[model samples]
Target: MKGVEIRLQVQYRARVDESIEACHARFTAGMQQFGPPFGWQDLEPPPAPYIKPASGDMIGVEWFRYPIKGLKLQITAQHRHELSIGTDKDTSDDRLSIEFKTSNKALDYRAILREHFPKLIEAYRGYRAWAVFDYYGGRYTDWNWGPWLGREATNPSYQRLCKEPGVDIDGRNNIFTLEPAVFWDNELCRRALGYGPEEVMRRLQGHALSVQPLLDGVYVVFDDDPALTYERFLEINKQFKELLGIA
Candidate 1:
């Protein structure tokens, strides 16, 4: 069977006053810790205002490693958008988003990430983040809000599909909260999980492969690699969500 690809990502609302130049400066400032990035390129067509040499226009970041084929670090900026979490009363608008992501593929990917993931999180300070191994398919945002919601027993999507009068298992939605991933970290852990980093570590003692407390958030790794067969992935994910009382 083909191996699944793992993705580690951090996502947060951009500062309202943040400028493209600022984003460029932040990337340059943080790159030193991870490694210098080269081969910068603009993501959009000509006259792309976000493009800046040695600073901006870079949607993907690559480091100089002797033999790693696809090892890369990516930082992407998104325009402001809104998602329908529920009813009109539940709507919330977010500022443009700033995301940082990396993948586990190359031989040295995990080693490098283990050493630098915390630094990346500190540099970006994302409110929601995850490290998951799933089939390469639809938008990450479409299926990833569950953990961000922490222990919410039900979300708008879940309620929409599972709670309507005559619906059965066939009508159940895939949205889940507090679902497990290979790795997790974010600034909202305390508020969302009802405990601080240390307590979270205590709670996850047996199930968690490793628990790390970072400067701004708690980092939890559930396994050596997020990638796994679909059945195995679901097994791990289910066990964890249930353990946390969020299944």
Candidate 2:
């Protein structure tokens, strides 16, 4: 697994899982691998057939950064494989994204982390963390389109993507991701549906290229809001399946 990691400073409410390697602890027994940066102390466990966290190593130059409190992260980084679209150098490996919190303002952890010489940890001052959730808890790569970031970025277009005829009650700070098998980058485009990005843009208020995901798509997950992006994606996907002659 190779990718860039982004750390931000925010105020979330949750407990901490001291170690990044969650292998020692698990939400359930017999769960293999501990990949996610956080312990997911807040996210409600996935329904029925639970999804255990997927684990793997991310090849990188070695670096570090920031945090927040109470923010829940429930991702099993199995989909650590992300492709570089525009440039052959998809330095996703260079990035390490995580959200943690500490009352120890006395400890200049950032300075200490850098002083040790492992690497420089960027200071994401005033960074706002988002609530990432999923139903089944899986990861995929088709979500990343390079320059276009997901809802995790500042000023995401949630109203157009998440809110619509009716808004999601808990859709705040929520964004959706789709499995590649479910749909792909160009499927909804004019070439596939006789409509261009503009039309899709008008419908979603966001470009497909802008739907960036963090770590294989685990951080983003599927659109939980059934009334908005979820249904829209499925509807468009139905047409795509018909066009592809898929049953």
Q: What count of clashes does model 1 give?
A: 0
> Candidate 1, TM-score vs. the true structure?
0.56
Residue 229 in candidate 2 has what lDDT?
Answer: 36
| Model 2 TM | 0.22
lDDT winner among the candidates?
1
TM-score of each: 0.56, 0.22
Off by over 4 Å in 2: 1-58, 61-67, 70-96, 99-196, 205-247
Query: Per-residue alpha-carbon lDDT of model 1 for 35-135, expressed as tens digits?
Result: 42221222211111243345533232222222234444445553322222341210121112212223424343355346544555555554445554453
Backbone collision count in every prediction? 0, 19
Best by TM-score: 1
* Model 2: per-residue Cα lDDT over 1-247, one tens digit each: 2211222212111113222233213322212122123322333233221123452343212222213333322222212233233222112212223333322343332332222101111111111122122221122112322455552322133235434543321221222323211111222232233543344334433322232321111111123231233346555434533433322
Q: For residue 217, what is the lDDT in candidate 2?
A: 18
Model 1: residues with Cα > 4 Å off, grouped in runs: 36-67, 80-106, 109-113, 136-187
lDDT of 2: 0.26
